[model samples]
Target chain A: MTAATARRDFPRAYGKVGSLHRERLWALRLSYTSLIVAAIIFLAPPVYMLMTSLKTNAEMADQTLSPWLVRSPTLEHYGATLENPLFLGFFANSAIVTLLVVSITMVISVLAAFALSRMRFWGSQTLATGVFLTYLVPDTLLFIPLYQIVGGLGLLNSIWGLVLVYPTLTVPFCTWIMIGYFASIPKELDEAALIDGASWPQMLLKIFIPVALPGIIAATIFAFTVSWAAFVYPTAFITRPEEMPLTIGVVSQLVRGDTFAWGQIMAGALLAALPPVVVYVFLMDYYIAGLTAGATKG
Target chain B: MSEVNLRKVVKLFEGGVQAVRGIDLEIADHEFCVLVGPSGCGKSTTLRMIAGLEEVSEGEIWIGGTMVNDIPPKDRDIAMVFQNYALYPHMTVFENMAFGLKLRHFPKDEIKRRVDRAASILSIGELLDRKPKALSGGQRQRVAMGRAIVRDPKVFLFDEPLSNLDAKLRVQMRTEIKKVHQAVKTTTIYVTHDQVEAMTLADRVVVMNHGVIEQVGPPNELYHHPATIFVAGFIGSPAMNFIPARLVNAAGALTIQLGQGLSVPVPADRTARYAPHASKKLLFGIRPEHLTETTRTDKQNLAPITVDLDVIEPMGMETLVHFRIEGTPVCARVDPAAGAQAGAPMRLAAHMDQMHLIDADTGRVL
Candidate 1:
């Protein structure tokens, strides 16, 4: 409640009223303090990376400058990273894997969601719960077992193996997101389509797809970001520098046991984070609408 | 236009709960039939069974002389308007109307012509380019109707189609629906819980209660000649009041004795018809409009009683007076100039000719 309203509720209690105003001031102070602290906590690393990526190597080793600021800014590392064929291959591999995995995940999730939410059959509820439950599995616990399966298929050190294991991380949650969107739609809409002579496939493509477009975009972001930033699966599956995605390639190749190429590493990290940031920025509204629609279905 | 028929249709849900208990009805070609009742009364369920949206646990549903028990809704050649309108939110009004015909593989020119014609018939031609979400509630309602009309199906099914509109819009749309029905000449079955809507829109009204048909007749017939006490009470506004009384022999004639020393002679024509139930407890039925402030007029079948009016509500066209008869609350409609006052004794006349005597034990009217 506002201070003015609180005072109006008890006009004669002078000391208590003072304490109420004090309490509100303390709350506002604490909230802004915590918010600034959180913003620093989340933003410090990215800012440091950008600052370091823009600094010359001489400024980095000089030991007389603030590490957070660049005295002389240059784009040398960005140019050098782009020119390196190995780094370019890493970018290409990450893009290919993300594209394939996202397309595959979307197809599987949208169909699974439609069947589970609309064409409900025996055990469908159990199956839907099972799909969400799979998303709860941590990647650290899943990687070793996936390692053996990748080795058995002879896809070791291949980006193709990463393509196979990525959907395990992406599909279950995408399907869950889509299921919430599908279930939120009113039941009568489908009944209307049925009376309108729409066949099952026709109903899905024309009605559910267009109506639930926001959910689809949200799920696409999930798949895109997950596959693009995946580290554990690619670390376990690929060993060759050329076969590695950007996540594994930057970390493994940019460090030589003791010395680090800080500039190239920061440049690579920023580059790797760009696509997801772009996807998120361009489609932020749909993502929020999708998440809320799923949450408030009932 | 094609006739629709239902024979012994039943809807038995899972867990042994019955929603509809084997009721039958028939609507003539081009007839506007309405199924109306209180909520959970199976009126909508019966309409769904006819539209093939609900399975009829055991009976035949015939549309245009064809049994459709095994047919899916898409193949049933019927269109239904939902209470929520159920217009496809993503589609333009024109596309929503044409989706059905497009699915049936109608040519593009034919689809456009049909959509345009239906749009004009509903006077929603300007709204055809807008999405359903962009239109007002009444406009969305028209788009839904346009979607149904463009198909030109064998039968039209409407499940409380106008329940979402405000009262003024509901009355206006009620007239709009009637006008459209006249223009289309399609056999339609509509469902609503509002009795006023049923009375105004239906060529035939079917009153349902507790999974069974209570009565079926034209609106005026059902109002004037109700066969059961339930129908009598359900058919009128302000409701028909039922006071506990007894059909007794009064000086070798039949008189219904209401307690508090109030009694009225049965009209001569009905005395022989009611004689078999003499000396039995009965319910005296009278509509609020039939009970009014007494004046010097034809007293052929008039009965007078003085009551202490408890509440008087002045509705511009008529004043309603409420009081109790032997602890049974009752209401009467009188001329607004009748000077009804609360807590004042007033004499009101009840027309005995329009009165009904119901058997209390069986709820049957004589």
Candidate 2:
């Protein structure tokens, strides 16, 4: 063999390549291996849920060692889950409440954030910090006190109660996120707009809102997800069956005392998670930017 | 065109930092007035105050006979080009140029026509569809100029607009701006720290230092007849040389005794200006180019000094000879064929006609 061919065949060649390249290759191999292993470990539970959702109850209960595949896949669970009047009602109520709550949160948060971020006013910085601090308060601890307030306002057992309560959890975080996002826009851009005869409202509408659309999208996703998957306040305040959102409705109606309807519960959980996933899929760039704007600006 | 008048304008920041102090200027119609100074000399703050971008702490600003203290930038009938070009990155060049006109509710056709005309004037018509980021730095600068031109405002404000370009492009744009000013003849107030730009582009230059007006005059006038010692030192490239000397009246002739036994008799006409200040110390100032290698044929009031040469830098047309007299370093521009060399003695005739005597104490020109 020629020297090049002989070296290639010997498998001990390319001595000039530094050790850093070999180390980097090893590191990349380990990273990919760990990444796939971690993904499988974390995803196994969800995969099992989906698998069980597709299987009949008989196949699901059959103590088979290999649970990855089913002899008979069925759509009974999807049909039953959709056909159930309570489930359908809860889905509709959840949709309406989540949409309304997210809408209200978006409107209030964006306006308040624009003011806090762009407008120079007394106590604005302090008020903005206070908004973030409010987000730090655990919802589990505040829901009890919020329940009495909601009940005192005669909004108990009503979707309005959940709608009003949902914003309490979402607005602070959303507004805080938006404030940071809006603040990241260069001050010169606004100054230019102002010099161009744009009023404060016009500056925000023409320059800021358009430039910070990504942040607003991320905040919207956050608020929508929070409102959709929220359980504590809704379960506490919304007691009526028809008024129930999906999170509490699935637990109360589908899973009874000692007889758990895992398929429907999993289906409801998957549907409840779908909106945020779809939103993130569509606007992941903005969501990541909104979350990391503080780091970038700093 | 419009005239801008500022009387006793002072700007004090919140932290008691005084940026502009008691600045008084009058820019006539179609005049290209340049406010030139080093950084922190209040030139920009003064321009911003006139543009209504910065609040005037104490002053009256009148544009075209109307006081505009509280009027906003938009109402001032002026357009300003910032140092960074400040073009809207998201907008196309056409849209960027059209923004001001559209804000005034100008007709669509008029806005388009004005933008197109400005684009043609700036030769950016083909680049109109491209965003600011798509254009080169010089192209973006032209787009900014086009935006200002499309406004057709009474005045234009340029805040160190060429500072962002490289040296070669800056020189080219300086000429471009001068030609544009000549074509439009709109009153312009430009601020810059580059003395070369001020000298080349300004109809009249305002030299500022430490929040005060050091001097104001035409470039050549400031170069030749600087009213103050600061202006003399600040105006020229290689700056005017300042040498301490003793002024005395001896034998009915006013003469200055420079160090190293050199004396220059002052002219009879100009000597009368400082005749009373005899026996006082003064600063003898002269430009490097004014010191000639050729001898003085008049043979009166001429000062010849022995220069201990440290280095000789030769250009094609002239040579810069570095030397010292009385421990103060000095440079003299001589013809390249003069055959001056390093570490050698050279004699230069200090032209008394082109010299200035400044007060040693207060630095006021005599």
Model 1: per-residue Cα lDDT over B1-366, one tens digit each: 489989999999879889999999999999999998889999988998988888889988999999999999988899999999999999999999999999999999999999999989999999888999899999999999999999999899999999899999999999999999999999999999999999999999999989999999999999999888988998889999999988888688888888868988899999889998886778999999989889735667889999999999999999999999999999999888888899999999989999999999888887
| TM-score for all models, in order of appearance | 0.95, 0.90
By summed lDDT, which 10 consecutive residues of candidate 1 chain B come out lowest? B292-301
Position B282, candidate 2: lDDT: 85
* Top candidate, metric TM-score: 1
lDDT of 1 by residue, A88-165 (tens): 999999999999999999999999999999996899999999999999999999998888899999999998998899
Residue B310, candidate 2: Cα error in Å is 2.9
Please state the error at residue B268 of candidate 2 in Å: 4.4
Question: For this target, which candidate reaches the highest DockQ against the unseen true structure?
Answer: 1
Which portions of model 1 miss their true places by more than 4 Å?
Answer: A1-34, B296-299
Poorly placed runs, candidate 2 (over 4 Å): A1-20, A64-71, B248-255, B262-268, B278-281, B292-302, B312-318
lDDT per residue, candidate 2, B56-129, as tens digits?
A: 99989998888999999888888888888877766788988887777779999999999988888778889999
